[model samples]
Target: MNPLVEVSHLEKHFEIRSGLWRTVSSHVRAVDDVSFAIAAGETLGLVGESGSGKSTVARLLLRLITATGGSVRLEGREVTTARPAEMKALRRKMGIVFQDPAASMNPRAKIKWSLRRPLVTNGFEHARIDDQILAMLAKVNLGPELLNRYPHQLSGGQQQRISVARALLLRPRLLVLDEPTSALDISVQAQVLNILLDLQEAFGLTYLFISHDLNVVRYVSDRVAIMYLGKLMEIGPVEAVLQAPRHPYTQGLAASSPPMSPHQRGRQRVLLAEQPPSLIDLPTGCRLHPRCPFRQTICEETRPELRELAPGHWAACHLAENLPAPQPRDT
Candidate 1:
């Protein structure tokens, strides 16, 4: 089957300006030559450090911002060059739940009013708007009483649920969940995650789940993509990538993650040194070479393209084959 979302050689660069005239001095390579796809009903987790450009990738996929170079197709339709009208139509088919639910919502507006905006803007009939809003709330396990309150009155989890409900109100084919549960308590996070899983199963929703938390990503993703300095270092089945990571960067991430079980506690850790390279002045060769513990001379002189090393698994490291298997961790 064809993929629901396909991205190829995606690139996004922001021009840096300086001086009184504000001339373009350099460019920050926010997303550089990234590529990946998501099949229908599949969740592809994007994991990386704070400045890894994960969120930029999400925005690019949604056409929330224009790409500097590359193609993004949604269900065989080219989205990168879609016109305003076309994009407006596409918005109904795709939704995004941002990291901060409270900020995404209006503090002054009641929940019911906020939820009704999409239906109203989409031309829902006056008589059916309330019914639709109520139905969506029920699906997210929210009650009608909560709808009368402002966003400030709702708990963090409830606000997030409202955000999810708003996204699903349009019945989108795909959803970009940007750190959805990060703002919630642990118990609340589980509830929200379960709600997302149940919603996906019921609605056949495809997801681009982005998070820095490895354990959360492992639990929610079918496949995981490891990113660094605006590039994808590794990507594959969640179990394979997390348990036997190939790229040195990915291995470090796995080792740094908190072990879920006692058996994993004995595993050796791979600690990286030095700060990430600046996007404006990226390293000459492989971006991670400066901090990579196993780096060789070739690593500093040449960059390696992503290559498949195992069935359906790919990594962008010249010495991936020679590196020892990543210590196993509970998933």
Candidate 2:
């Protein structure tokens, strides 16, 4: 079957100006030639360092911000050139839950008001609105007593559950979860994560789960994609990419993340010599060559296209074949 979502050569560039005239000077390639797909009912975890264009990709996919150039298709319909009415209709098939629960809702509004807005706007039956709200609240494990309270009256966990509940009101097939649990406490985080997993199974929803947390990604994602400096460095099944990352960038990220077990805490890690380069003027050739420990002369002269290193696993690196085997991450 065809994928639920497909992106091709996705690119988003921001123009920067320096002088008083505000003349265009350079472009920051926030997302450059990135491409991936999410199969139906699949969660593709997008992981990267801050400012690596993870959020930018999400915005571009939803057309919350326009793309400089590329194609985004949802269920085979092109999104980039969609008309206003068409885009509005397309949005009904997808929903977004942002990282901060407090910011997602209006402080002045009651929880019921927030939940009812989407249903009312989408022309959901007016009489069934209250019943629908009640049902969705139950799915998120929230009680009706909180519905009359303001957003500030609820706990952080309660607020997030409400946000999730609101997003599902329209019965969307795709949900873009952008660090959905990052702001909650550890205990609350687990609760929210479990709720998301349960909801996905119950709803058969496809997810574009974006987060910096590898452990969370491992737990929720079937496949994971590693991104850096506005490019995809490695992508594959979660185990193949996380446990045995091939690209130096991926290796560096996997190593720096908190170890899974006490015994693995002291294991040696791949360390880069310097930080990432400026996006306005990215380094030539392989973007990662400047800091890659295994970079060779060829790496400095040519950019590596993503190639299959193992079955169903791909990496963009000149030394992927020559690099020493990586230690398996603790299961």
lDDT by residue for model 2 (4-33), tens: 999999999999988999999999999999
Off by over 4 Å in 1: 259-270
The TM-score obtained by model 2 is 0.95
Please list all clashing residue pairs in model 2, or write none if there are none: none
Put down candidate 1 lDDT per residue, 232-322, tens digits, no spaces.
9999999899999999888877885453234543442335666687999999779998888888999999999999999889999999999
lDDT of 2 at 294: 88
**Highest-scoring model, lDDT:** 1
- Each candidate structure's TM-score, on Cα atoms with residue i matched to residue i, is 0.95, 0.95
Candidate 1 has what TM-score?
0.95
The parts of candidate 2 lying over 4 Å away from their true place are 259-270
Each prediction's whole-model lDDT (CA): 0.90, 0.88
The C-alpha RMSD in Å for every predicted model, in order, reads 2.8, 2.5
